[model samples]
Target: MSVTAITASTNSSSVRGSANATTNCLRLRRSHILFGTEKRYLSNQCVQNFRFTKPSNECGQRCIRVEAGWLFKGGGEQGSDARLERSESANEDILIFFYQLDLATRVQYALNLEEYDIAKQLRNKLNEVEAEVIKQREMKRGSSSKSEAQDKGISLLRLRADLQNAIENENYSLAAGIRDQISKLEADSLAATIKAQAFEKAEFEFRLGQKVRHKKFGYRAVVCGMDPVCCETSSWMENAHVDQLTRGADQPYYQVLVDVHEDPNLLVAYVPEENLLAPEEPDKAKFDHPYASFLFYGMDSAGDFIPVKQLREKYNRPRHEVPYDPQQDQTGDDNA
Candidate 1:
């Protein structure tokens, strides 16, 4: 079973007062069977009110630690070692289930289960992942020169990390072994953020961009962005431009963004491109539109602005299946 499935099965309890003992025993056996292990010594009294998570531990130390190849070691026996070695094969399944959890979620799960030691281990794992991410960023930027590479270990940029090195140092053989370790770290997590999010579908000739100016707003003013009108467009525009700019209406219009010289407040006017013109005094125009960073990735060396990543990561994040989590832990899990 998956970790989530295991957690759910372990956490669930529904039995009559008379049958509680029988239910607990049966369930415990089932769990042991599922884990491919014989039952460990657990008291009947403890089984009566059993919970997968720790109920009371003032110091909040984890009672159990799940490791990849740990064989329940302590007493030396080759037979036990053989059994443990066999357990490792079974435990590989458990490790894969654990990793399916989001990094933050795994930490929260440990903390909520009162597994502080496990949480600490996960925190350490987080640091390693973050270090790998920073290293990848540096490697992509070619920051690992000879001296710098010696100072920081061989940085892996992933996907084409080896390719970049091979091309740089001209070693094609090792480059062929490149595997994309980056797929795990590239947490776009911005699936909700729409790309090049143009607000209106009104057929217009000029592609909406900054550096455009409002005739009445004067020289310093620039078109920062366009948005959809909630109600009809504001009636402030001189009757020359249609007032309404809501989406999906006849002659749908855009709420053009423009800065006012006198008032520092953001000014959005519902109008067509005809209502605005290119900045007459190009020298005075400001291309540093405030919304550009959120909308566009930084400009390339060629002076051309690049759009942000259009493709997004999956949005279906795992939900908390276990109950009885503390409020603070629950809040952190919500963020995860």
Candidate 2:
């Protein structure tokens, strides 16, 4: 009987403990349901507020919360989904700024290039101006040199004219002095020319028995027995015989001969070597006959042979009685 009573007591206590556990579980379930509903309402309000606010107004708040959540996730906070979105936007803004800055730099560079081109063109123009200035300077130098040469020529011409006037007026002393000056100038100027030509002035001294040609006379013997007083010295002169008929009574019959070629018979006056020149050859057709030769031959009053053209002229007169026929005796003498 004692064991049965103890068992009954244990059963009752177990039932009471089970009933209290069931009540406590039901209350806990209700409290959890109420808490879940409150959480859902808070989530909906947060979504609404995020959607209604302007991007400029909500960006800061949204970024803060999103960033906090991303950090809590701990998958490299900067590279997380929400953080990546913000970084992309920032990158776009940076790209736009760089593009604008690049465009502005390009425009400035183009303007600088244009200025450089203009400067190059100006440099070319300056070079042309410098070349023109050099050309003008050279031309001026040439003109000045020409002017100086012309002035010198004019002075020389005036001096020559003055000397000529003095000579014409027979101012012997003045003319001589001026001539000397002119000669000196001419010698200075012609020094190189004279050296090149190897020319010499005429000397008064001459050799005896030397064969010389003259202007009027053809050829003759040089007789050196006679004496004549000349400008420089006494010269052994050339003498030639002339018929008395050919000479005038007042004329000096024994004329001194200088150049034999001027007149073979020494009929003409003696001329200095400075003034002497060769005579021109006669035309062959004009005097080709024996009569022409005879006309030049010498003869005396009594028909004697004399070494003179005057004697030939006095005796051998032109035969007017005869016709000028090639077959006729042109001298009108039929003695042959």
Name the runs in model 1 displaced over 4 angstroms.
1-202, 219-252, 259-263, 280-289, 298-336
State how far residue 137 of model 2 sits from its true place (Å): 7.0
Estimated TM-score per prediction? 0.24, 0.15
Residue lDDT tens for model 1, 1-336: 112112212322211113322212112221122221111212421112221221121212322322232222222242222121122212222222233233455567667767676566657755554464445433322233223433223333444566687768967565555433333222221211111122222244323333454444342333222222222323333233333323222332333333333222332344444445654433333344333544345543323233333201111112212234387578889999
* Candidate 2 C-alpha lDDT tens digits along 137-204: 33322333344445545665777998999989998899888778777656554543332222112122
**Which candidate number maximizes lDDT?**
1
Model 2 ranges off by over 4 Å: 1-142, 183-336
